[model samples]
Target: MEKILVVEDDKDIRDILKIYLKTGFFEIWEAENGKQAFEVLENKEPDLVILDLMLPDINGLDICKNIRIKYKYPIIMITAKTSDQDKIAGLTYGADDYITKPFNPLEVLARVKAQLRRYKEYWKGSNEKNTIYYKGLILDRNSMHVNLNGINLKLTPTEFKLLEILLLNKGQVLSGEKLFHLLREDEYYSKSTNTITVHIRNLREKMKESFERPEYIKTVWGVGYIIED
Candidate 1:
């Protein structure tokens, strides 16, 4: 059974998730703070981590950053902060997904399952072409590696997926809503364009592409974003 480590301080929230995730048949580990979270990590490695941004000790962003240094497992950040900046901050720190407070338990469950599936698929490789070469960039699906101008660049799964999609559909515009739907691996739609915006910004920064005059992945204003062939 896949294990899930939930780092949440609120007992009620934790209990709610425990019940729902347990129903999903996942082995759940509970941690009320960053300290206990690390302790859990020391003893057992979970397949996915459900992290809360507001903790009694140790900010959740720091915990996510620390985890990224060593582990590549998927992380879903849960926080009461509803602002786009808050969500962007979480993503900037390497979180795979973000959920605001008052979120539906079912949505959380769905995201957890979606993340695990994507994580597993990333490691195992998919049926798509093993490698794609465009301009000075090389993306290898089998190895889950990307290189640009003979230099390797580390990318989060979300960033990698976005790049793959853009490359596959090069020279075409894809709206944020469309990209978000594709990323979620479901048809669920919400006014969450900021998620894609932050991710694309991250991708550009890693690629060293200038936002003002990008060589690739250019924004189309009211249309969407596209990568020129």
Candidate 2:
């Protein structure tokens, strides 16, 4: 059975998730704070992480940053903060997905399953001719390997997905809503264009392109985004 680590400060929420995830047949571990979360990490590796954005002992973003520096596990950030900035901050720190609080348990389960599937895909290499080329950019979707100008760059999965979509559709405009749908592996996450905006910023940073005059992924003001053919 796949294991899941649930980190939240509220006992009631934690308990509910424990029962809910157990019903999904996941071997669940619970932690009330980042301290306990690390202890749990030392003991066992989980297939996915459902992390609260705020923790009493340690800021959840710090934990996410710390973990991503060494591990590539899929992290789904959960928080009460609904602002786009807050969600972007979590994503900037390496969270694979985000969910706002007062969340539906069913949505959480769907995201959990989606993240685990993506995790497996990241490691096991999908059986597709995923190496795609556009201009000087190269991407091997199966291994999530990416290169540009013959120089390799490290990219988070979120950035990879964004750039992959843009590359695949070269010259065709893709709306933020369409991008969100393609990026989300499940149907639970909010269809917020702001999420795409933040991710686009991150992708530009990794691609070493200035947002004011991007070399790729041109923003068509009042429309969407596209890359020239």
Candidate 3:
């Protein structure tokens, strides 16, 4: 059974989540504040965490950072703050998804299931493909860590996912359109957006490489980009 840890300040919200998600194949764990949530995380080790942004003790962003620092476990942040900046902050801090308050519990459940699916797929890549080697670099999805010549590269969650996609499809030309869709899923992306280019540039910079004369992500002129084998 997959375990779910729900961290919320409201007792009613916690009970509602348990009532809906506690199926025979899924066990539900609850904590009313960030302190209790961390205690549960230390002991129970949930498969996924549903964290409230407005926790009474310890900001939810702090909790997200702490979780990302040690573990790559998927986190779906729930908050009343629905601004784009707030949402971006959640993602920038390693949240896999975000939900607003007064949301449909059914929608929450769906997002929960979707995150687990992607999380499982992400880890499974390491099991099937093992380390992805290119030049002197090594990528280990299982550990959510990457290193070049034994030196770890400090990567944001977005950068890590972008690199993972590029390495997974090594030598195959991946269009910017495909990458954006894959990275952001069916979210608020549009054809006119150049988000992929920005992310690619950032990734290349971290690789100490560039698109003009590249060693890693090679832009195939009019054909998007590829990591040459």
What TM-score against the true fold does each predicted structure earn?
0.93, 0.89, 0.73
Instruction: Please tell me which predicted candidate would have the highest lDDT against the true structure.
Output: 1
Please give the lDDT score for candidate 3: 0.78
Candidate achieving higher lDDT, 2 or 3: 2
Candidate 1 clashes between residue pairs 3 or more apart in a chain or in different chains? none
Report the lDDT of model 2 for residue 17: 85
Over 4 Å off, model 3: 122-128, 141-144, 153-161, 170-177, 180-229
Candidate 2 residue-wise lDDT, 12-92, digit = tens? 999888888888899988999999999988878888889999899999999889887766778899999988789989999
lDDT of 1 by residue, 39-134 (tens): 999888999999999999999999999988777789999999988889899999999899999889998998899989877877784677779999
| CA lDDT of every candidate | 0.90, 0.84, 0.78
Error at 68, model 3, angstroms: 1.7
Runs with alpha carbons beyond 4 Å of true place in candidate 2 = 123-127
- Model 1: residue 93 alpha-carbon error in angstroms: 0.8
Model 3 CA lDDT for position 83: 81
